[model samples]
Target: MSKLTGTTLAALAVTVLSALPAAAAPEHHGDDGLNWSACQGQVDPRQQCASVTVPLDYNDPDGQQITLAISRIPAAESGLRHGVLLTVPGGPGGSGLNLPSSAAKRLPPSVRDRFDLVGFDPRGAGRSTPVSCGLDHADLAMVNLRPWPAADGSIDGNIATERRIAETCARNGGPVLRSISSANEARDIDRIRQALGERRLSAWATSYGTYPGAVYATMFPRHTDRIVLDSNDDPDPSRVGRGWLAAFDQGAEDRFPDFAKWASAPDNPDRVADTPEQVRPLFLDLAARLDHSPLPWPGANPAELNGNVLRETMLESLYADARFPDLARLMLAGLGRRPLPAPVLPPEQALQNTTAVSVATLCNDVSWPSDPTGYAEDVAADRAAHPLTAGLPVNVMPCAFWPFKPAEPPVRVTDRGPANVLLAQNLRDPATPYRGALKLRAAFGDRARMVTFDSGGHDAYLANGNACGDAAVTDFLVTGRRPAEDVFCPAD
Candidate 1:
């Protein structure tokens, strides 16, 4: 949430009202020109908020404008300052205005002394002049956001749901919604650099942010300093988000064993099975039972715990080992061994806003096939092959019914950039599996050095408790150096 006080809001209004004359691409400016203001809901009092105005559409720079909300925690030591180190978070919709606080606490003091930690809310998210499609509360549920086919693998319902979301967004979302894409995000980041009066920037980006971070590195190679991309997405220009979604099938398969092992452990209070092998069958049986008769979950967004809902919970719980209990407890409830847990959800407005941005960025990035027949066949085939995810990865989405074609081709990350790039990955990341991370590493060619941490769940670097992996990345960020070859850290 933005920490904008009334005075800060007025300052933002004044800043936007007195818009700077739209310039050429960000390269044209080296002037410091940010309007710093009051940012609310900040975890670190030292973090300050500011706004940077950029062209709403990069193509027509002189046309209209939009404000991007950014935050920064100044370098702790003035003499050692190297410049801005931008932090990019995941989600085409992930809010980054407070990311400086999140990143600062985890970084080493050596890094803290060298750069001002900077973060921003992308154009269509958080306080960056947010855009919303006013979607129905029911449509905002995770089970619905990613297409989860019917019990028999039919996509008839997916097609309709996707079409309705697309149509509603088209009618209600204005120019801003149509403008969200990775290419534009790259452009926005460049503008922020110019606004900060910095000649170059180092960046630490994770998950979806890595796409734009890579694009920024590719598009403005000379201006990028040190670059760190963690838990990366496959840079498939043609497929984009489609390929990312598909990875969930393989990712789920790779990460489930860890959960199974934990769930059957004698010390675990939430153990759901007597043995690791039995856990899979138990989960599949419980899900199938829920499909036949959904448990009445009173306060949940959808008001029921169906098979799809269980699958959605499983997908989220696989993100980190710490979240393993969420899935275990849900399994216990499904088996009537314990009561159902209360639904934990974000604020309705935040969900609505982020969902709108997510759909827009995805649909506007690339085209999706509109053929319902083809989607149904793919779903049926995927279900038979990967029952854990039940074809949710290959299923259709709102992009199938998107109202506009992509404004420009997706940015193709290449090997031509500087060798300052460092790629980090967890061996068993459920959202971004090793296979996909490899594709991204290969795309960067000799320009990057990869550090693979043999572990489960998503995120690497300061996230998982792998001191070896964290030291390698921290060493690189602090001294502008990387391992001579692709390094691997054996399981801890």
Candidate 2:
């Protein structure tokens, strides 16, 4: 899922009779007394905001209450108004509070004018009754959040780190933390639809949001209209979040070539190597050296650049082709070479919320392999196969040591939904690779037609800059016209 830094880049199991009406009933807003004014400040003047209170635990609707921050930008041209179009932001942790504005900008004017653009911060994120694991600043760093093995592929440090983080969250995170699974998020989305009084919602869900979107369509088929899943993740129920965590290895391998080419281009101002082939080894050696001796990075959260820290930054930078320079500059700086200073990290509160929600959703979505030996072997094998990432993708995370089991099973995505879904993917997305997307596509089966872009980056619609891919998606969102079959958009 795309973090808040922006530019770059970029599940469920249950049916419970919460306050929400049955899936077969036409959606209607009851006397929930939702006040659109509460959503102010986060919404544009053209958009109205509302707070929909949902049960923190769907199984016990009357037990405790949680609010979902929801906003809607009504059709700009009322004469052509069609229906509501929801923009589901990525990130099992990413907040969709600001997505209506961002997505409205990317949409074609015709589509933008016809459909009301909606966005919401999923439970445990942003203004929607946020959850916090109360992790210290140092523990919230991306390097710490994403497990990375030691320089020698030893799992000792990683295992200890996972245990510590897990212990912290388990102690600090309240019952809300246990409710932050993908299945719950999907259920919350359906509840939002009911609150909006919409029989069906046209949606554009990206990254991790794709999983919940798929689940929503499966659980409530008739409620989806013109669904668009961008930068999709694999819907392997058996693996769930573990599968996504492991996919980074393949994703990095798929996307590194793009970075290599950019970094080695002779004419580029930030070129780091003489040729693409040299970029990989140069990066590996630099990371290894940093692993042994980290440099002091004053402004960074952890206040230093270790090998794993650099590796984490590399993974984030690869999300967007435009961010390659950020990684290259960091690498150059660590190599006893002068480069630009690193960007400032978000405020501590922001980081805490983002990190907390990310971990809660990921760890709560599925049970991870608890066997330390399994992680050790996988990390070692991954290190050998994809050295650029240095086995971090397969390394142990807090999920491996999480104290609580998933409250519910993962939703099995199947071909039981309306055939209104269209999936768009980049062939080389560093975050959600094509190989994983194939699983999601297969889960949807005859219900979806995929438009694969032969491009590089995390996002695939307007963000990818592929005219072929963009046109296909835009047409579908606007006119409901889908390709007769799966299609590929060649590199431009």
Which candidate has the highest TM-score of all?
1
The per-residue C-alpha lDDT of model 2 at residue 184 equals: 79
> What are the Cα lDDT values of the candidates?
0.83, 0.79
Q: How many backbone clashes does candidate 2 have?
A: 4
In the predicted model 1, the residue pairs found to clash are 3-39, 3-40, 4-40
Please provide, for model 2 over 3-75, each residue's C-alpha lDDT reduced to its tens digit, 9 standing for 90 to 100: 3111100033333322222122233344435576534564456666778889988889998999998988878
lDDT of 1 by residue, 332-381 (tens): 99889999999988898998888888888888888888887888888888
Winner by lDDT: 1
Error of 1 at 474 (Å): 0.7
Off by over 4 Å in 1: 1-31
Estimated TM-score per prediction? 0.93, 0.92
